[model samples]
Target: MEPTGKTVVVVGATGPQGRAVTRHLLGSGWEVRALTRDPEGAPAKELASAGARMEDVASLLAAANGAYGMFSVQPTVGSPGTAPDFSAEDEVRWGINVAEAARAAGVEHFVFTSVAGVERHGSEVLPRNLVSKWA
Candidate 1:
């Protein structure tokens, strides 16, 4: 694809899905700015090596400023290697923060990736990780 000359900020860009999106966007000629808590981590470094600009979550709004779009993803409760005490409320709060920041940054498009099965199974019956997405 021809270069669009557009930039997209990706939250959780070191995660599996996020990494895939970041790589695809870069391959498609869209500039990618990646947000990660651990900018020095292996996955984050890998994305940087692949041409993704890295930023910390605290500076997400600034990084997203003037960007054309944003791709957002959040970690789930009980996610392997994640914080052992992860909470659904925390996930929901993080998602809201990213969305609000994107809006404040005037992003043209906001693509939020959430868990599957929330529609099939109601929030009450779903796991905290899945229910957090519904919230």
Candidate 2:
């Protein structure tokens, strides 16, 4: 597809799902602004090389201010070395913050990618990470 001249903000753009979404969006010709904790990291650098604009989460809303869409994908809870410090409540809060920011920015499209079990079961039956996604 030709460049649509539209922009999409991709949160967690350093992670697997976020990277995929970023690549797809860029391939489809939408200007991609990737939000990440570390803009100097390798993954983020790769995205920038591929024509994405990298922005930190703190400044995401400003970068997405006039964007046409937003793709939100957060880190998984219990991820290998990072699980010990992960907080489900914090994850949920961050998700809410991103959504609210996107809405306030008047993004025409919002895509939130949740875990697999979230849609299949209630919160009580899911793990903390999944429950956070459900919330």
Candidate 3:
């Protein structure tokens, strides 16, 4: 694919899946805008060195004009040594926030990463309680 002049905003760029996707998009010649909480973090710095436009989430949304695609992937609340304050509600909120932001920004293609079956119930009142909130 000819990604030249086409920007792809990758969310969670510091994470595993987001990093892989960002790398692939960059390799395909896309103008990559990697969004992260900490722009000075190792992963964001690495992507910046690789020619990506590393920006915080707010700036990323504002600069998404003419963007061809967006990849949203928020990490689940569960994992080894995760903060005890984190909850399933936070995950659902993150997913919804990303989708709404992308839509409001008019991104041409919004690629939402969620668990397979969980997506069907995203709007349900109990989305956060599902086994896989990504759905």
Candidate 4:
């Protein structure tokens, strides 16, 4: 892959998938602006990221400004290290907010990661954690 040296805002930079994506992007010569809720937290410190909340579109837009691309991956329900009160609806809302901010920031490239059993088309049996993914 060619290194474009472009900026790519990574939402959820401290999570499992986000960490891998951040490392890979950096290795590929892409500038990564990692977004995390707790900029002072250990994980954010380790990743050297900026602070941004998924619930705050303005903050997310600010963090994503001047970026050429954006990657969005929200936490799963009951995932390790996630808040106990985090629900499927919260995940959906967070994803939506991130997308909205990215669009508002004029991001040209947007990549979103979704879990299994997340069918946009109606499915009789959807995973509990992904029940609201397509809703």
Candidate 5:
């Protein structure tokens, strides 16, 4: 069967999980818009070759135009071992950006891939990113 004319926007399309989602969605006959800062990068280009669109996140609203769904996974700042230069605030801000954009674009399905172990453990010991991924 052909695609049902539905489009899914994968916000971290260059990353592992995002790439997997993009590929699966494409294989399943859904249109995929792969989000990335570098459209020309190897990963984004590879996705593009497989029928996923490589688009910049400068304006998520514009990027998500007419999108039926959105899958958002914040950057490494939200991981267990946060990246050297990024803070928790940065991760949350990015997460919020994606969420607000999805809402603005009227995307019906939204998935925010969050980090682990934050709920079981106390926030004091964890990196801010892990504790407040979308806060």
Candidate 6:
């Protein structure tokens, strides 16, 4: 479908995946709302230069109106041996937070970036990992 005035709020706009998605969406003529922790930072500034509106993720709930989609991504755990640790929990929390916020904001679609491994777990550890995800 033609993007036109459709908006997509991309979480972690300052990160690699978010930046690439923002750039592509902007190029495709969709109104892109890039969520970042710091709007005045260099990465956010770069997105602004490309004609994206930068906003804080925590403050994006009500601002996501008319959004056609939401692109969710979490920060990395940052090294080996971290998967079974707290990093896994953190990722799950971030994902859930974004999903809930998107629902509250009336987003029509939510695109979550999840690990392929999560599908393999299939156990109570999923809940444990989710609890620590945002920690």
For each candidate, the alpha-carbon lDDT, in order, equals 0.88, 0.85, 0.76, 0.76, 0.82, 0.75
Q: Give the lDDT ranking, best first.
A: 1, 2, 5, 4, 3, 6
Q: Which ten residues in a row have the lowest lDDT in candidate 2?
A: 74-83
Give the clashing pairs for model 1: none
- Per-residue lDDT tens digits of candidate 1, residues 1-135? 788999999998988899999999999999999998789999999999989999988897899899999999888897754688888888888888999998998999999988766788777888766767666
Q: Which model, 4 or 5, shows the larger lDDT? A: 5
TM-score of each: 0.90, 0.87, 0.77, 0.78, 0.85, 0.73
lDDT assessment of candidate 4: 0.76
User: Which candidate model has the greater lDDT, 2 or 5?
Assistant: 2
Compared with the true structure, model 3 gives a TM-score of: 0.77
Candidate 4 per-residue lDDT, tens place, 1-135, comes to 576768898888878888788878877878788876666668777666332222232478887788999998888777666798889888888988999888888999999987754664464576655666666
Ordered from best to worst TM-score, the candidate numbers read 1, 2, 5, 4, 3, 6
Candidate 5: C-alpha RMSD to true structure equals 2.8
User: Which RMSD values do the candidates have, in order?
Assistant: 1.6, 2.1, 4.4, 4.2, 2.8, 5.4
Which candidate, 4 or 6, has the higher lDDT?
Answer: 4
| Candidate 4 local lDDT, residue 105 | 88
Cα error of candidate 6 at position 54, Å:
0.4
Residues 1-135 of candidate 6: C-alpha lDDT, one tens digit per residue:
365878899988778788898898899988888897678888899999999988876677755767889997776565222354546656667777888888988899888764465555545656543433323
Q: Per-residue lDDT for 25 in model 3?
A: 89
Which candidate gets the maximum TM-score versus the true structure? 1
- The residue pairs that clash in candidate 3, if any, are 114-134, 118-135, 119-135
